[model samples]
Target: MEYIGSRVINASRATIANILADIRRLPEWNPAILSVTAIDPRVLVGKPYSIRAKLPGSPTIIYEQVSTDYVVWHLDGLQAHETGAWKLVSLADQKTEVTHTITHSGAIFRMLAGAFRTVPGLRLDRLQRRAEFGQERAGREN
Candidate 1:
């Protein structure tokens, strides 16, 4: 099964991508994320990190597919599963469109994943708020 979502943000792709691509800010934006541990902010791709999340119960999910376009997340339920990238497409007028997708198989896995179908939507809301408020460029006032 595959799940996908998109959001139009009122910020430059550079700002949004820099924020999303920067792993250090994950927990600050996503409520479901409890903590992101042991990651090097300087390293942006092709590395694994453990993220503990608050989805009824705290579970540490692994980020295995860290790439420029197709990131993936692995979750263990009755079995293991996956979720994917933060794809950012630039638009005119200082806006950008963001999408997140996931692919997994198994009845229970899909069912549980369905519950999080709104995650990308919620994450987008948080991203827009942060970007609109200039939180992405924090402490860099020139």
Candidate 2:
């Protein structure tokens, strides 16, 4: 099962790219991510990193991530096993588009994620929140 999400931030691609380049800033905008840490070489293409997160009301879990321009997170669980990606695409007129996609490979995964399939909606909400936060942060620094 492949779940895809995309959003356009009301900001320049350069600004968005700068934020994307810094994985440590995720908590400021990513609602689903409770916290992120650079356990290895940090956010560099072709490098490996580890991240720990608290999934809503669930216990904290750790996942392995590999960065390659596009980053992929491999998550393991009793009911669901999947891979998720964060991709950045720059458009003309200083626009930036970010797409987040997830694909589940395990049998129990679909059943488990059925209730959580509302991710696309959640992402849309987070997109607006993140854009506002980014805009304000950028304004303050300028």
Candidate 3:
């Protein structure tokens, strides 16, 4: 099964992508992510990061930035056949459009894909508020 989502945030592509791609800051914006530990603490292509996230039977994540516009990764111990992608597009006036896509072949994941589809959207919502307004809006949210 595949789940995809998109959102527009009022920030430069570099700023938004920088934050999203940085493993160290992931848990700061994404609640599901409990922690992220990358060997180099940088998002290089084909880097495997140890992520302690709130997912099923997974504490490590394999990360790879396929391109400046796309990223692919899979939850370790979840299923080799399952993977996810993030697409970032720069828009005019300091705005960026981000699209998230996840493909899970597991039977349990496929059955729950509908509910999981909203996870990215919710993550993006928090990201948008933070990236656009920073702590002022984010502080209020918390």
Candidate 4:
């Protein structure tokens, strides 16, 4: 199963990219993420990170970094390894297009994946809303 979501933040691509690159700030933008701990504090492109997040049922979910720019947490180990990404693209003028993509693969995931497809998109929506709210708050402060 593959799912994609995009959002336009009032901030620049650089700002959005910086937010995405910092694992620690995920909870501020991503509602599903409660805490993110970089197993290795390095900012290398392929570094591994560990994330502890809250799921729909209030259960904590632990996920591990799989490869470059990808993290996989087993929804049911036997069912699927959930893959997700954040891609920032510079658009015309001063706009930035942020795309979040997720893919689930496995026999069990295929059977039950549709039930979870809405999750990634909803998370991305929350992130975008947070960004917009931050921008509005900053504007008011100035």
Candidate 5:
């Protein structure tokens, strides 16, 4: 199963990409992420990082690809395997269009597919708010 979401953010592509690349700061913007503990603090492709989320499992996620405009990561959980990709397109006036895609596999994911459908959209909404306003302001608004 796949879930996709897109949002136009008021920040530049570099700004948005930088935020995405910094896995350690995920919890600051993504509410579903509780914390991230990386083996290496720097984001090197192929290195695995463990993320504790609001959900049931603490998945080991790896950065498969990272570039100026896109990023791809794979998450291995006890019950599911997921691949997440982010594509960024620069727009006029320092804006960026970000598309987040998640492909899920495994029996558990297949059975709970409907419940996960909204995950991507919710993450994108939080990311947009974080990019447009500072974390402090976004938190207040939320």
Candidate 6:
């Protein structure tokens, strides 16, 4: 199954891309992520990282692609295979339109598709708040 979400953030495309590419900061922007561990601060392609999330189990996540405009990562855990991609489009007035796409295939995800459908949108909302305001302000707003 695939789920997609987008938001217009009042930040540069580079800023949004940098935020997404920084693996150590996942918990700051992604509401589902409770913590990240044993990972480099800078996300490198093909490097695997672990994240503890609100979900039932921790997932091993690997970045397949990373760039200033986009990033793609894959997650394996809970008997599921999932891929996530983030694309940034620069807009006027130093703004960026960020599109986040998630695709997962497995018996577990198939059964829990409805429950996980809103994950991308929620993450994007937090990301927008984080990118626009500082982390401290974003936390208070949330």
Q: How close is candidate 2 to the true structure, as a TM-score?
A: 0.61
Model 3 over residues 44-85: C-alpha lDDT tens digits? 666667777655665566676655477677665463245767
User: Tens-digit lDDT track for model 4 on 12-49?
Assistant: 66555555555666677666567766553323454444
> What TM-score against the true fold does each predicted structure earn?
0.71, 0.61, 0.76, 0.63, 0.85, 0.86
Residue clash pairs of candidate 5? none
Q: Model 2: clashing residue pairs?
A: none
The TM-score of predicted model 6 comes to 0.86
Candidate with maximal lDDT: 6
Candidate 5 lDDT over residue span 44-87, tens digit each: 89988888864466678889988858989888877888888999
| Model 6 Cα lDDT, one tens digit per residue, 1-142 | 8999998888877677778887888788877677878547688889788888655666788889888688899988787778999998888856888899999887788878777789889989888877888653355468
Instruction: Tell me the deviation in Å of residue 47 in model 3.
Output: 2.2
lDDT of 2 at 15: 56
Give all candidate RMSDs, comma-separated: 3.5, 4.6, 4.4, 5.5, 4.0, 3.8
| Candidate closest to the true structure, highest TM-score | 6
For model 1, residues 1-142, the per-residue Cα lDDT tens digits are 6667788877776777666656667777777666776557733444555666543333445566454344455654334355656777777656877787766665556557667667677877887888767655564444
- Model 3 segments more than 4 A misplaced: 79-82, 135-142
lDDT of each: 0.64, 0.56, 0.69, 0.57, 0.80, 0.81
Error of 1 at 71 (Å): 5.5
Model 6 has how many clashing residue pairs? 0
Clashes per candidate (backbone, < 3 Å): 0, 0, 0, 0, 0, 0
Off by over 4 Å in 5: 39-42, 54-58, 135-142
Candidate 5: what lDDT?
0.80
* Residue range with the least summed lDDT across 10 consecutive positions in model 2: 54-63
